[model samples]
Target: MVTINLTLNNFSELPSLLDVFGCFGNDYEYTTRGLLRRKIPPVCFICSTLMVHNGYNPHTKEGPGEINIGR
Candidate 1:
């Protein structure tokens, strides 16, 4: 097995890094050091943050041009 390590100083930098990995697809495991763990998804964090900032909700009538429950 092989291990890859990355250093990041800000939470906001996460989205762009993930985007780079995604172009390669399914051949990596992402984790943080000494904290929590999660499986990443194929969505853009920046976009999600912006949507929330704009008062758009997946369950609302004005979210991302789609209607209700999930965006």
Candidate 2:
């Protein structure tokens, strides 16, 4: 299994998307041993974990210390 997490420096400035798309499929490709392999992309349901900690960031303070202080 593979998991990927991404953070954008200019995330809030992103324009609204007119449409969204998602898929749960796999790609068939030959491996080094000439055997067919299925490559699947990881699916992320909730990704907005955090940007940084400490008492900083004047923008959305989504970090654990600022936002989620408890639990």
Cα lDDT computed for each candidate against the true fold: 0.45, 0.34
C-alpha lDDT of candidate 1 relative to the true structure: 0.45
lDDT of 1 by residue, 4-71 (tens): 35565655666775665555534445555442222343333445432332243354333647457966
Model 2: per-residue Cα lDDT over 23-54, one tens digit each: 21235333445444345423323553333322
**What's the CA error at residue 50 for candidate 2, in Å?**
25
Output the lDDT of residue 48, model 1. 45
Give the Å error, residue 21, model 2. 27
Q: Which candidate is the best by lDDT?
A: 1
lDDT of 2: 0.34
Q: Which parts of model 2 are misplaced by more than 4 Å?
A: 1-26, 41-71
Lowest summed lDDT window (length 10), candidate 1: 35-44
TM-score of each: 0.23, 0.19
Ten-residue segment with the worst summed lDDT in candidate 2? 16-25
Cα lDDT for residue 37, candidate 1: 23
